[model samples]
Structures are given as structure tokens and as C-alpha cells.
Target: MGKPDAEGHGPAEGLPGLPPEWGRVVVPDDASALAVEATQIRRELRRAGSLPGGHQALGLPLVVLLVAVLTTLAGLLAVTWPRANRGADRPTPAPWSPPATLVGRALPALDLVDADDAPVPLRGLLPAMIILLDGCPCPDRVGDALAAAPSGVSVVTVTGGRTPSARPTIERQARALADPAGGLRSFLGQPARPGAATALLVDRAGLVTRVLPELGTSDTYRNDLSVLAG
Candidate 1:
């Protein structure tokens, strides 16, 4: 209702959302840009199956979870493949020390008598080798081994500490021993587990050094005694 100002404007002309701040100014290039932008927005909306709305940011986290799950699957596959392909590749260790229960800590002092009533000191001998055997046919597996041992070494055989079942006869090999079981316990420091044989080698200083069982014989005992005697 008011007349135009000197700058060719009215009160409503400069108001936002009604028209341009001054008056309608036409730019053909601006119209073209708007049309192109509208086309791009419509294409994006159609590709997404809906117009962009709430939860649009939730898609990023879903994509991330899928990638993490794929990575975990790959790691599991790698671990399982080697196990599936395992062949007879296990290793067997060489002869070594026996368990602590078999070979005790320090060698303890032992007392024994010969065919005659004489006391012998176990300490300060050049080298002492003890063999435990069940005297039946008294196969004496280690007798020759001990006799032929080095000059300075002493070879003593301890019976499993049992009185022979029958009377002494070369043929009745089972009859010559008494108290064999006890000797095994006192000398070898072993509780004499049945069907088991244990051997001990004490050095010149009487130090409890090497122990050999029927299975896991001491490397040092075999090597040192063999080297000294052999």
C-alpha cells in the first residue's frame, strides 16, 4: 500500500521468504544449478530405497561390524587349517635325566657287608657303580660290565633284598639271594617298584652324582663310566 522507495523497494520486498531482499533479480545460471542439484538428490534418494532420514548414521556402524566379523572368521580358518593338516611330525627326545621321584636329591649314605664281616666306607672311592637286579637265574646282567669296569671304579651289585625262594644251586638260579629287595631300597634310594631296575654311580668324592633307571639312564653315568672303563 506504500509507494516504492528511491531504491525501487517496498516494505515487503526486502522481507525473507517473501521475495529477494530488494526486488526480484533474475539469473538464468542460478536456476540451472538448482535444477541439477535437485536431480542428483532424487537419484540418491531412489538408490537408497527411501529418502535419507533418521538412523542414516546407523548404517556406518553396521558396515563396521560386518568387516570385523569377516576378519575374525579369517583368523579362525588360519588356526584350524594347520591342525587339520598335522601329520606324524611329533618328536622323540633323547635319553636324559629321570623324574625326581626316581632319582632322589643328594645321594644318601648306605651300609652294606661283604661275604665277610667287614665295614667299607662309600665315600672317597675313585668311582662307584651300583647295579640292582632280581637274583633269579640271577641273570646278573651287569656283573661282567662291572668286573671289566675301569681299574679305579668299584662295581657293586645289590639284590632286590629278598631271601632266595629255593636252595643255592647253579641251575636253581633263583635260590642264591636273600634280602635283595632291601639292598635295592638302601643302596639305590629307590622304593623298588616292581619290574623296574635302577642303577646309581657315585663319584670318587662320594657325591651322589648320576642315576640310571632301566629306561632313562643318566647321560653322564653312561658317558663317564664308559669313558673311564672303555
Candidate 2:
């Protein structure tokens, strides 16, 4: 039994075994409030020299938690920083153009004869420039264009749907061949238009890399052939 407080309640009523003078101290009802009261008591104890300094009170566990957080942040930055820089420095590759009809297909063998009336094997003439023209006598304009063809690419002119004829004038310019049965046109997957020449760029493996349909002019032919050779 203790003395009654100003509120007319005994000091030991709520806080048992505490003096009447300590009645002002509140008794916490929950865990959160208890933690708050404990912290306040520790601060007062430190000021009164009853407890250790604030840094010593927050000992090795607090130091370890701070170090772990800093290390994790540093590790994350080290991993992500190089990726961000590399993405900025990397160059995008050029887009490849879609293949035209007959392009990207393997060139099949065809029965072809040269101006000398000798058999010419299409597969043996790999990586060669096979230009298909519409008529027998190779046109002077087309012959001159074939003459300006880039080096390393053999130019063989095939007359589409026409028999082999003596073209003494153009023979010095290009090796003129004849496709009497229109086999070359069928091999192209389409019919050759009137006076329109189609040039096929064949690789070393006898694969058609490009199909230039209705090639415009001698300059255009020369430029296109140069690029293919390069």
C-alpha cells in the first residue's frame, strides 16, 4: 500500500513495487511502446553515466549491418555499370535487303553451247557473271557493257529462246552462248521481257546471290558488277 497520487490512484496500482515519487513514469502496454520506453531509459542512463557511450551501446551488430548494405550496393553498381557503358558504345549491324525472285536459290545445270559450238558446263563456270539477253545477235550496247565488267568475274552472255549464231563482232567482247530450248528463261523462274536483260550474280558455290531484273544501262551494269565483285 503506497500513498495516493495526484490522480487519486495509488503509485503501486499500475506500476507495482515502484515508489510513490516514480508514479509519473508510465507503464507501457504494448511491445512498440515498451521499445520506445527502453530507448528513452538508455538515453537517460547514458547521460547519467550509468551506461556506456552511444557508439559503444550500438556495438558490432550495427557496424556489420551498415557494412553489408554498403557492400551490396557497391556490388550491384559494379555489375550494371559496364553493361550500361557497353550498350552505349556498341554499334548496330546493317540490315540485309530481302532476296528478290531467283536470288538465294541454287543455280541448276543447263545444257549450254559457246560461240565455238562446244559444250559448256554451267557448274564448271562457277562464280561467273551469266547475263541473259532476249535475241541471237548480241546487241552492240550490251556487248560494250559486258566489256566493262569487273575483273575476276567471267561474263557469259546467253541468248534466251534463240539458236546460236555467228556474232563475230561481239565474240571478241564476251563469250556468247545460245539457249535454243528456252531452258535459261525457265531456269530464271520467269520469262524474259522483250529487250530486257537479266544478270545473275553467281558465287563460287554456283549459288545466285542477286538477280538484277531489267538492268537499266551500261553504267548501272558496270556499277552493279563492281559491287558484286567487291
Candidate 3:
């Protein structure tokens, strides 16, 4: 036995066969203090990878952030994938042609005949002004158009709906014709209205230059007729 130190405890003298590097071990008397020491040792061993069955526990905030990131990525893919694929895979459609209006275009293949059942040669009669009379005889307007026509311009009035037995006499190098089938109105796409007249000015090249929908004045006819004659 060794002599007592100042703390009134004897120095360690047992286990002399142990190596010099082995130090004295201490044990606490209280059970609670022993449990605390055991818990600290286990935690250190787990962190150092010396303990088995140890895994890191992710915090609630970290798990929520990961889930949000994945959801955002999925949403981005859903929104953009179809648009990219459509631009790459689908062929664009061709532009549509405008509706058939005679202005700046050649006349369609038409077979027109006069009231006497004689075939009216419209193609042959180029550089002409055609006045379409709707729902009335419109003799005064027809007369004004015939008189105002320039020397080379031919005035042709086409009346729709009926074939009267007493037709106006074709005078002043103008021809009074009738379209009982409403074929002329359909060809020109003119809407039917009471006392509404439409004027079409055709050039020498068989291309319609101007289309006046509501023919108001004879001066309109005169100006377009002069242009047609020129």
C-alpha cells in the first residue's frame, strides 16, 4: 500500500503487471452520472463510425426544401416540354387565300347571255363598265350612265330577278341585258338590297379595276369610265 496523499486517499498501487502507459480508471458512484457518461460515449462512437446501426436524421425543414425543389423541377418540365416538341415536330399551316373579289384579279370562267337569249361576250367586251340594277327598272340611272360613258367605254346594264317582255331599246352603244338566274349577282358576291346598284369597271386586260358597291352618283361612273377608256 502507498502512503495517503493530501486528499486522504491512498495512491493507486494494484495491477503492477499492466503496461506503464495504462492510466488509472475512475468510476462514479451515482447511477444517473454513469448513465450520462455512457450516453456521451455512445454519441462520440457513432460520430466516429465506430458504432453500428447509426444513421443521420434529416430535419423537417431540409426534407420540405428537397420536396419543393423536386416539385418545381417537375412543373417546369411539364410546362415547357410540349411547346418545344410542338415547334420541333409539327409543320406549320399554309396561309389562306383571300375571298374571290374581282378587283385586281381576272374574271372567272363565266357564260353570260342577254335577254334575247344571245350570248354576251364579256371577255370580248373588255374596258367596259357593268351597272347591276337590283329590285327596280332604274331607267334614269341607266340613262345617265349610258350618256356619261366615254367614247370608247361600253355601258352594259344587267337587271336581276325577272325577264320582262318589254325591255328598253339598246341605244348609245350600250346594251341592256338581263340575268334572270341571279348568276351575275352571285358571281360578283353582291348582296341583294332594294334599289341598290353596283358598278364594276373593267380594264382592257380583262382585270376589274374598281368595284363601287353602292352606286350613288353618275360622276362616279364618269370618273371610272374615263379611267377604263384610258
Candidate 4:
């Protein structure tokens, strides 16, 4: 053993299990205080499940996936729920049925004769308007309709037997046809009446779209003629 130095330090010696460089380290009695505080902080973090390397961190991915799934479910419910609710409250529309009128019925077969008392073939000569000049006054009604008649439509004047006595000029102007058998009147359902001037409107489809019982003006059949022309 050597004598003590002037600072009262003993001779240097190796620790039992420490390395040789440990002798160069400066350790005080308070050094262990910092180490104890660090150990206490680690223990508290473990209890609170906040440790980055503990079991809580290991389950972090599963928690994030669960939150993402919940968010997706919420978005889906928001989009489709309103449409389903609206459809449930909407009313269903009723089916439509055509009215019971001559507008929907086809024209009946006609029996016509020309001026020479010869049978006339009515094939391919439509969309035409038949003017019933049987008891109708002279040529005014037939002439007005013939003048106002649209292009593509043929005007045929039918009489009980003879040419109208009042105005033979305009009466002969139209395609004069005689229906002595009363077949045209019967098919039209027109009764015998004075000044009974009825006009039957026939389309290219041979469908009777209108039946004017007592025609007096040009505008009456003008609108219907335009549509038929189209």
C-alpha cells in the first residue's frame, strides 16, 4: 500500500467487474437521483399505455383500420338513404285510355259515282274531305271549303242525285259525285235536315279525325288541315 496524496486520495485500483476506463468517469452521490427519476417516468408511461414500444403501440394499426371502416359505412348511409326515402313516398301514375269518339275510328267504305253515272274508284285519292251538298244551300259552303282546302287534300262534292239548283258553276267546279243510294249519308250517321252541310275530314291513314256537322267558316277546318298535311 502507498501513502495518501496531498488531496487525501488513495492509490488507484481496478473495480471488481468494471472496465479499466471506468476509473476515468466522474460519478457523484446525486448521479443515481437522475437514473431513479428516469426509471419512475418509464414505469408511469407503461401503466398509462403510452409507451411507444409497449402493447398499445402494437394495436395501433387495428384501431386505425376500424376507424376507417366506420367512416366508410357512415358515407354510404348518407348517399343512398335519401333516394330510398323519396322513392317510397312518390305516387304511381295511372295508365291512359283513348276517348270514345270518331277521332279514333277508321272511315267506312264509300260508294261514289261520277258525272257520267259511272262508278268511281276512290283508291289512292286521299287525304280528302267529302262535302255533303245534299240539302246544303247553293255553292257557297262547298266553294269556301274548296278554296280554303290545303294542297294535298282533294275536295269531293256529293249530292242526293242532281246538281245543286242555285249555283251550278261552283258545284261543277268540284269533283261532282252522286250518292243516290244514300249510302254515304248512312255511313256518316247524318240525318236528313234542311241546310245540313256536314264535312268529313279523312287523313292519309284513312282515319276520320273530324266531323263538322254544320260547317260555316274556313278557320274551322284550317287547323285540322295543316296537321293532316304534315
The lDDT per prediction is 0.45, 0.60, 0.61, 0.62
Q: Cα miss at 160, model 3 (Å)? A: 2.6
Write candidate 3's Cα lDDT for 1-230 as tens digits.
Answer: 23233344454233233334444322222224345545755565567464353333333434443444344344334333433333576778754322346788776545556666776666677778877776455667667777787887877777764442234535664576666777767767746556766777788888888887666668766777888888
Please provide, for model 4 over 1-230, each residue's C-alpha lDDT reduced to its tens digit, 9 standing for 90 to 100: 22222344553222133345434322222323346545755565566576556656545644544444343344334333444444787788654322337675676666578767777654345787877877665477777877777788877777886342233454335667877778877767646557667777788888888887777787778888777777
Model 1 RMSD in angstroms: 22.7
TM-score of each: 0.38, 0.48, 0.50, 0.50
1 against 2, candidate with superior TM-score:
2
Instruction: Indicate which candidate wins on lDDT.
Output: 4
Clashes of each: 12, 0, 0, 0
Output the better candidate (1/4) by lDDT: 4
Candidate 2 structure quality by residue, lDDT tens digits, 1-230: 32334334533224334345433333222224345545765665566565457566666535544443344344334333433344777788754322475777888888788767677877676666777777223466556655676776677778843455434444455667887777767777666666667777787677787776665556665665676566
lDDT of 2: 0.60
Q: What lDDT does model 4 reach? A: 0.62
Runs in model 1 with CA error above 4 Å?
1-98, 101-106, 124-126, 134-140, 160-189, 215-222, 226-230
